[model samples]
Target: MASVCINEALTDDELRSVLSKLEEERDKEMFGLVCKRWLRLQSTERKRLAARAGPHMLQKMASRFSRLLELDLSQSVSRSFYPGVTDSDLSVVADGFKSLRVLLLQNCKGISDRGLVSIGRGLPSLQSLDISYCRKLTDKGLSAVAEGCQDLRSLHMSGCRFVTDGVLKALSKNCANLEELVLQGCSNITDHGLADLVSGCRRIQHLDLNKCNNVGDDGISKVSQACSYSLKKLKLLDCYKVGDQSILSLAKFCKNLETLIIGGCRDISNDSVISLAIACRNSLKNLRMDWCLNISDSSLSHIFSECRNLEGLDVGCCEEITDAAFQGLGSMETKLPLKFLKISNCPKITVTGLGLLLGKCDSLEYIDVRSCLHVTKLACDEAGLQFPECCKVNFTGSLNEPDLL
Candidate 1:
């Protein structure tokens, strides 16, 4: 009689227990190859997968991985042959992965309102969703999602141009627990929509309104007032309509703001910048005020003196910023925590100012002085020798003559 194999005698539960002990994917694959039963068990235990979108492939995945919790069907620009995921593919995902928690469908051009409806009805347990650049989706689809997925904490809908105030209203009504919302390039959003959203979702911590031209001081002030304590990071890049009143409101109410980007907000002046620096001195860590031409040495002086915890700063292209700004920074008695600095394209800055900054900031790790008319490549090369071994300086366009070597 043939000897009985110990592996064959083990029950399904014991096999599963052995599989759970293997940490590496290679080890798990080897275990599955030992027998047909192990292979079947491995397929059922799989939890996350990222694959090209197709109806037939999705069907096969659903049948094989019944407990999959995360699915990524985002398409790459180089792979244009695959016409992108459609509503039918989403229907299959909704029907099969009822316990799904995270779904990413970025750049799925073929998906529209119909696909989102299927997701809303089926995936009530979802906590995060990224449909960024899915331009075909509008208020109708996202409203359905807000109504169904009340557990949602993060939502990214960047470049969904068709979305307007209506979706914000819907989300405000249902998704009160939302913490991160990225609406970059949704140009149709206005002050009223923002006020409504912030009133309901007071827990929002990170909000990005980059390129939402219609948003101005009124909307931003409302956000600062409602989500004052909870807000930590905000990006208003290229929101030209935003001016001093918005920043002033942030300084007064949002004391916990850690990161702020107001680049291209040309109307911002030294007064508001100084106010913000004083108010958020202890908490502010990163600040970018590039192209805010109205700010000058006074704002930089206050920032250097007050924001003791500041680690990163960018005032690039502020034409009015001159050597005086660095003079104040150099005069500081206390060692600065600043690690990154960018003064690129400021025509008034020269090697004298750069030297002053380098002398004081021993903690510097990265510096960008590119396009400063008076700064030379020769000077930058000498400065590189003095910087710490880890420091890197970008003087890309400073070379006016050929190197001697």
Candidate 2:
């Protein structure tokens, strides 16, 4: 490849094409500073903007990037954190970018229904909206979004505490094209709300209901019935009431299911897990059963044998898993070698058993065996030494050092 000169003169379209390929923020800024033409082209070409310096900065940038299509005003709690964007800024952003398609306002805690109303009325072309962790948002704010952005395909409202069944009803009626929804930690939502949402939004494929404690087996069963054919990725982390019955229902209908995370669903047993693995065997790729105490080696045996395309497996904190559990993976033949495995807190998994498992997984890249007392730091180091330098072995929880025996 020949080195390209930054000073090379190109048409506006050519500049836009070259600038779009630059992924790094610094590179984009440098490209803008290349020349007057480059600067103008870069400013007009920018469609996606993520600003953490609050809404005022975003407002200033909006003037220059008139073609802005996606805007992210999300906040973080890091050391560099500053005052968050408010309704005033959101209104400004909405006024500036009428063609905006995606907006991520996660953790902008100061926003209320008034700002959302403005956003809904202003950004009518919005297709994807992520307001997750914005605790101040209520049903009123959400209703405003549903009414304004009826063409929305993806919505992430996780950690919005005040949201309830009313919001789901509003979304179901308005956002019929909705394909992906993430309501993780929205404890106020129950079976009725979930059932209502799924019933209306039959196109929903990706759903994240993590920590939604109020939703039980009935709610999940309703989801399985309504969006089973379209649903592909489902996460139910710490959903205390969800158990084997929900899995069984999903297995029967969700034939195209690919990724499932039921971490902390302690009520899940071997039979239900095995049945699910068998049902979605061809499509299932990632399975995480962390803290599902009832599952043991038996479930792993069935999963490894049936789920041939399994690429990632996490059985962390599954106390019932012993050295015998890995025997299944070691014996099975897989087209795609398991790349990532997490067996953290599995006390019964010894160094010998882990080594055997590692030997079988030719493409294994990362393995976390933290808190496994039988697997010492020395063993982990030795395991890493055997594999190509690219592989990483984690044995952090154990304190025992190597002894010169």
Candidate 3:
């Protein structure tokens, strides 16, 4: 693409808006070469260009793009493109972007707490920060965010191994309006820290504790106990330590629960599933229990009986379930409000059994029956005859899946 030449008379605000959309570093560099007028405007527009383009191009306009509001250096454009953004990059980032609100430095292995603290010192308007996969980030970096970023609402710190109970305590005390929190793959937080935090952050709505293997029933129970009324969205994916007891507590307390995703939790039994269905029957809109080994057809029926407003359901790889689940589903004439349904890799589902759901469930827009050997093309053809709203379908290694898209 040719360089976009701008009129010299255009105001500064107009120039900034045009420059913000440029995704490539080469485009910004070529803009200067296009004309003398453009060359002079490049100095003021450099920050907009540098923040959007990968950190590799930050050096080209390091001194200029100092007042950037949003900095997303999650991935280097190319191996040769990102020019090793070290601790030096932090100083330029802090000095330039005084109004920086959203900063995403994901997968930037070289960045540490020192660079992050510089951000806290520089930007008081920082609200949303994501430092996922930055293993070197310790309690110091988290403390800086809690103390410095007074308006912080969303914080994602997945795999920051050094973040401990102290960081949680600081966040609970300092960041009172915190609404969304993602602490996936972090092992440092314990029950004591989490218990204190849930009691403090009464406004927490969305929480993801995926793969935080260190958290046991004590921590999950504490969260369920403290934030049951406030918590609307919760994701406990791959939380191995979670069990029936913790789930039971959540089902009883969380009244306005909209979404509950608990995939790969091996300890969750049929009793927990029954309790969740029975307790949150009216409020539950979406429930995903993929790979929960102990769950069976009985719990699936429990969901059908209770959760009337379910929109999305994923019961993938629940091997113990047979045709009885679908039979129970087809027996009723009630059109499920489900938009997304996935029962992939269930060997027990035969052609007749699986066909019942596709035919009976009319509101389904997306379906996934991947790796079910017994399902045949004729069966799918017959099922698709009744429901035509399905826009997307998946058949991962299934022998006969004619309805699949």
- Off by more than 4 A, model 3: 1-67, 77-84, 331-333, 378-389, 397-405
> How far does residue 31 in candidate 2 sit from its true spot (Å)?
6.8
Better of 1 and 2 by lDDT: 1
Residue-wise C-alpha lDDT for candidate 2, range 1-405, written one tens digit per residue: 988875565666877889989999899999988788788888888888877654567667877888988888888856224437788888888888877999988777778888999988998899999988778889998899899999999999998989999999999999989999999999999999998897689988999999999989999999998998899999999999999999999999999998899999999999999899899989998888899999998998788788877878899998888877667566555444677788889988887777667666667777777889888778667666365355567778333421210
Question: Between candidates 1 and 3, which one is better according to lDDT?
Answer: 1
lDDT of 3: 0.75
Residue-by-residue lDDT tens digits, candidate 1, 1-405: 999986779888898898899999999888878777778889888888898757788888888888888999988867645558899999999888887889999888889999999999999999899999888999999999999899889999999999999988988999999999999999999999999998799999999999999999999999999999999999999999999999999999999999999999999999999999999999999998999999899999889889999988999899998888878776678878888888889999888888877777788877777889888678766666376566767789543422110
TM-score of 3: 0.79
Give per-model TM-scores: 0.91, 0.86, 0.79
Tell me, by TM-score, which candidate is best.
1
lDDT top scorer = 1
TM-score order, best first, reads 1, 2, 3
Q: lDDT score, residue 281, model 1?
A: 93
lDDT of 3 by residue, 78-110 (tens): 652443445567766776667677888776677
lDDT for every model? Answer: 0.89, 0.84, 0.75
**Residue pairs clashing, model 3:** 47-65, 56-82, 56-83, 66-96, 66-97, 67-96
